[model samples]
Target: MNVDLNIIVFGSTGLMGTAFETVCRKRSISYVGMSHQDIEITSMEMVNNVIERYNPDTIINCVAVPSIDPCEKDPELPLALHCTAVLHLAKECAKRDILFVQPSTHAVFDGLKEEPYTEDDQVKATNIYSATKLLSERFVATYCKKYYIPRFPTLYGLRQNNSMGFVDKVITWIREGRDMKIADDKMDSPTYSIDAAEVVISLIVNNEPYGLYHVANNGCVSYYDFVIRIKELMNADNNIYRAKDSDFSSEIYKPLRTALQSVKLKPIRSYEDALLDYVNTDVIGVSD
Candidate 1:
C-alpha cells in the first residue's frame, strides 16, 4: 500500500476515466492514461504492447460502448467492446500478474427488484448493453483471479461530456432556457464521478479484495426529483419542468427502480452536494 505504483487507465477521455485521471494527478500517483486516439482497446496487440510498456501494477478499464440506444439498434459494437475486448484485457492482465479493475453498472440487473441490489444478487440483464456487460463480468470472473468488479449506478459530473449523463441533459436545458421532461417513476442512485474515482483509487492503492461490490451516492431519487434538485442548484426556473416516464416510452424496458446498495465503499457526498460543486465549477455552457 505504500509503494509508488504505475497505473494504466483505459478510456481516459470518458467521464469516469477523466475523473480517474484528475484524481490520480491531484494525488500525485504515477499513472499513464490513454484515450482512443492513443490506442484502440479492441486490438489485442495494442493492449498487450501498452501493458508491457507501462508494466502497471494495476489496470483500470473505463472503456465501454456506452450508447444504450445504439446497442439496442446494433449489438455488435457492444459485444466487441464490452465483452471481447474486456475478456482479452483480463487474460493479458492475468498473464502479467496485474490487478484488473472494471466498473460494472446497475444495468446488469433486470430492474425487477423492489429494493436495492447487492453484489451477490442474481443478475438478469434486460437490454443488449447490460447483457454484454454481464458477459464481460462473467469472463473476468472466470479468467482472471485478481480482479474487482464494482457495479455502480448512473454517474454524472460537470467534467462529464454533454453527450453522456442525464445530469448534463438537465444542465443543457437550463442553459438553453428550454423546458425539460423528467421521468418521475424511474429511480436509481446517482453517484458523482469524483466520488467513484476516489473509491476506485483507494481500491488500487490498497489492493482490495477481489469481488463484486456496489458503490454509489448515499440515497436514491427519481429522474424528476433529480432534475428538480439540479434546477435548484443552478437557480433555474422550476416552472419550465415537466414530468414523464416509461408509461410514455417503448425503448425503456427496465423497472422503475434499480438503486445500488454499496457494501464496500460509501460515497463521500450526496448527489446534490457533488452536483452543486459541478455547477459552480464548470464554465462551459451545456450543448446538445
Candidate 2:
C-alpha cells in the first residue's frame, strides 16, 4: 500500500483492534481507531459519519459479538453487529473504493477434520456466532470490490484494560489458590493478537489477493495441554485438573477442533513462543 494511505479501524478497544493500533503506531502508519463508545456500528448514520470524517483508504473492521453464549441468548445483536452492520460497512467501502479488511474466526468449521482447516474447505458453522461470522464474510465478499477476510483461531493477548487470556485465566486461578478443570478434547491453534495484526498489515501492504485466507500460528494443542504448558512455564502450584467437553453443559455449540492453517501467507510463530513473550513482557512484573 501507499505510505500515505489512511486506515480507519473499528472496534478499537478489543484485543485485535488494540494489536492493530499498536502495530500501526510502531510502523508509523496513519490510522484512526474508534471504540464502541465512539461510534455505534449498528447505526448507519454513525458509520457513514465516521467514514465521511476519516475518508480512509482502508477500513479494518474488528467488531463482533466476541462470545458464543451471548450471541445465542440474544440473536438480534449478532444479526445487527455481525451481519447487517458488516454489509453496511462493505457497501460504504465499495462505494468509496476503499479496501475492507475483515477479521474472522475459525469457528466457521465444525472441526471434524483430523487435519487443520484450510481456506478452501467448505464452512460448517455449528453455532450462532459462527453463522453470523460466515454471513459477514459472504456480505464482504459480495459487496466490496476489494476485500480481505482473514479467519483466525483462538486469540489471546494484552488488552487495553490488562485483561488475560485462557492461559492467563489458569494463572489467575492458581494465584487465587482455586482448583480448575480444563477440557482436553477441545483443540485449536491459539493465535497471538500482535502476530495476527502483523499478518494483516502485511497482507494490505503487500496487496495480496482479495478473498478468504486462514491466518494462525504454526501448531495446534488441546485446552488441557495448553493450560498444563502455562502452569509449567509459570511453575505455579498444582491445582489444575483435566476434563472433557462433556464435563460442561452449554446452550451454545462449540467446535471440538478448529485449528487453522494458511496456505497463502507464511506461518507465524508458535503459540508457545508467543505465550512466553506475552508472559514475560506483560505478566511478569505486573500486578493485578
Q: What are the clash counts of all predictions, listed in order?
A: 0, 0
Candidate 2 segments exceeding 4 Å error: 161-165
In Å, residue 221's CA in model 1 sits off its true spot by: 0.5
**Per-residue alpha-carbon lDDT of candidate 1 for residues 109-224, written as tens digits (9 for 90 to 100):** 87778777877788888889888999989988988888988787998874534355677667767877787677887888888888888887887677788878787877778888
Q: Which candidate is the best by TM-score?
A: 2
Candidate 1 regions exceeding 4 Å error are 1-3, 160-162, 238-242, 283-288
Best by lDDT: 2
Provide the clash count, candidate 2: 0
Clashing pairs in 1: none
CA lDDT, every prediction?
A: 0.80, 0.87
Per-residue lDDT for 1-288 in model 2, tens only?
336668999998889989999989888899899998899999999999998988999999999888788898999999999999999999999999999999899989998998889998889889899999999999999999899999989888867745555655776786676778899999999888899999998888888888888988889999988888777766677777889987899857788989999887788899889888877776665643
The C-alpha TM-scores of every prediction are 0.92, 0.95
